[model samples]
Target: MTQAVTVRRDGDTFQARLFWWHAARLLDPGSPIIRVGFENGPKSFDDIWVEYDPKRSAQDQYGAPLRREHVQCKWHVSPDTYGYSHLIDPEFINANTRSLLQRARDAQLAYAPDGIGVRFKLLTNWRLDRADPLRQMIGTRSGAIRLERLYGSATDNSKAGAVRKAWRDHLGLDEEELRVLARTLAFGEATDTLDGLRDNLDVLFAYVGLRRIPRNESAFPYDDVVFQWMAQDRLEFDRKSFPAICDRDGLLGQGEGRRHVYGVKSFEHPIDRLEERCHQVLDLIPAFDERYIRSEADWGDALYPALRAFLLSAARDQSKLRLALDAHATLAFAAGSVLNIKSGRHVELEQRTTGERIWAADDFPPDVNWASLEAEVVELDPQRPDLAIAVSLTHDIAPDVRRYLSATVPTVGRLLMLTPSTGPGAQSVACGRHAFELAEAATRMVREARGSSPVAAVHLFVAAPNGFTFFLGQRQPVLGPVRLYEFDFEGGRDRSYTPSLTLPISTRTGDPV
Candidate 1:
């Protein structure tokens, strides 16, 4: 729950914005939501209402009856001085209870249609500070001491309880009636402040379009995409405008396909296909830091054009790079592309064994190729027998576990154990380069045994960074389906290993297959 940070408190635009945010989630595609009235308009009820049908006009005499709702938006900021006594402050009581009752009454009389349902909703950004004794008095417990005192069952009342009395007098309701009204009042509270909300909005934004580099607050210099959308008028809190955007984008429920799938469930491999249909959004951090963030007045101008160009370039390469490869192919592609990007020219790719041409110097290359250029090609077996490649880039496996795997899994086929080369006095660290190297070595082994026999299977026993795992996926169109394993380490020692999900390797990526 985030209070909208982009607006001011005095003007109370946040209430409207809050309404906009909620309405977007509620309204169905093409549901008729009419702006019944604004603040202080005569013959109007609260904020807005949804008509039973959009096909029939509200003005039509024989049209369908309008099914509507009453929504009241309220914004409350905590008092500067903290005290239990502030809970009874006339201002707080007046804003929340008395005024709300009057509004609800007026709206009911003006708009409640016969035999049609009406929902009363109160949306607010209040904590209802628990320090207030008044809040405690409204506890859900039926036999509570606080409820008894408020209802006069317990008869000791001072000036502190007068706020409840005022509310009762204004609404002309008894204790039980007030309790029922309280239950009917749909209260939505935002516990999170604006800043925290903004951070979450960033993650949500990633699903829609952009991908940003992961970094600490100090390292992240640009304004967030949500804030930018707010500033540019792309995001609004109006009754008609908000729903229209949701309908256009198909964010109706769990979202339309990729907007919800890859964006929401990136952890799970796709069930129906090898990959998602969505394009990989450009990583904007590098360009923003290099060209705009610190440069005062010209930042926007510089950023906009640079972003446009980068997006265009990515779009150009998308079709060619859409194909997914196994660790081997991903390595060669990455090695060649990384070298090409660094040199500002294409790199020649050659087969290790025959020195046969693979990619010419002018050929377009993928990003992970830099490490592949320097990697050695290892032959698996001359007879080209079945093989199992166990890639461990993170750390050394326990001797006992290794021996078990050797005996349990058939050794008639070669077992190529791939690990990062450790340097003197330096602890082994897994990274993109190391991941690519392992894949490159595995690629050579696979190539040598291609026609002789099936790959048997490639099993990954990995303890690596998320970035490394992600890159490993990027390089896949492996010779066969790859299986990932999870190892449990208990008491700082290896305990057991369990098979995880199988990787969905796409051969040529047009759609997710």
Candidate 2:
């Protein structure tokens, strides 16, 4: 039997696991949710609402791409009266209930052709009391008569009726809208709590053959693991791509043939081999002196310090740290995508490399005139104009970059915009093949533009997956010098751009030198 540890609950751990649970559903290849995120969305929900397209596959999911469903998360160590009651009580609606309602109203309006319907869902760990009428009311699509019957009137004098009347008055909803609310509001339950998720994460690592970090030694590094996973996978992890090592059913001995096979034979050989593989991957994860893995040591703070120390050690020569840091950021962003928003940098180390190979397109698009597509160019007028190329993959090219280009450059050279077919105001990159084709097109543009004007340098403003960035660098047309700029989220969307690193172009080979 596997060891079971009673883990303590922390809010951060709960949120992390909740995020992962949401990931399992929304990030699944067949799921409709194309994007999701933490704590930075609509007013009411602490968790993000997602815009899901049922037709799309798993590769499309990104963080906070669109909004469709407002998810509110409520965490409790155990089932409680206040928490359960507050979910439905009108006065107890989350702080920004009015805003959420307004957004919902906008979605329902017929005048807005592109309007998307929004729904509210409360995710909780507590096993709901099915017997409770309010719980049942939220669980079902219809307004329950229990409250109405108990109170006898919409304006009943009793406390229950008063509460019901207050809720209706607060929402200012008519009968039809109230019915819509009953249908729109829903609840979802997870199998794990904070400690449960931590334990399972260890199991996940162990399934890949990694040794467990004892609970007493450190809280499970959920965020670090998630960052590493996203970075390594190029933000493409989903349920089918990355399944839980052991699910609730499997842990309960309910898995198909597991019980029968256990009685008939010893499967230690295969299990041992699998565990060995897990160990191999575990070896790749950077570990510190074991002192920093504490649960209370600033939630998810272990990775940065460990990464900094690793970079410093590897870049023993202080003079080489800048270049090393750039190289490290490249690998971390491209492979693991561990970007730090505040500093406008990617947070990851140089030592670790992903087992999975980064994606690349196999062939270029056969047909299509690359030159005909008007290239949006910026000329600084220094004899040979420096070419600035902005390729938008997951995010729309920031409007600020567009304004800057328009304002700084007097005349238009050429502009080509690639956007996602599915998302609004954004261009999407399909599998690596499409990304490669896009890169080839960019290269063609460079060559064509250089033929007409003496191009001295290239500056890239890319809002794309790190894999696409790596592939873009690979497919760059031969140029004298290339500088890439990282988007500045702090400066506002699509506005501020900062210099990241220069791609050294080889004059001899015409490739990234």
**Model 2 poorest 10 in a row by lDDT:** 258-267
Weakest lDDT window of 10 consecutive positions for candidate 1: 264-273
lDDT of each: 0.37, 0.40
1-513: candidate 1 lDDT, tens digit per residue: 244452343214443333332333223232244333234321213443333333422211112233443445544554322223432343543454435555554554454422124434444455444555454443221111233435543322653356455656676766655544433233334433444333433333343332333536543222332244445656333446654554554433332222211111111111111122223322222221211123322222443333234433543443233221212222223222222222233222221111111223233334442332122223434454445444544455534335545555443245555555441111232233444444455556555545455665665555443323444443446445555554544211245554443444222334221
lDDT at position 316, candidate 2: 36
> Mind giving the per-residue lDDT tens digits that candidate 2 earns over 176-282?
56544443444555445456565554433432323355768665555445544444443443334334422321321221111100000001110011111111111
Estimate the lDDT of model 2.
0.40
Q: Which candidate is the best by TM-score?
A: 2
Q: How many clashing residue pairs appear in each of the predictions shown?
A: 12, 22
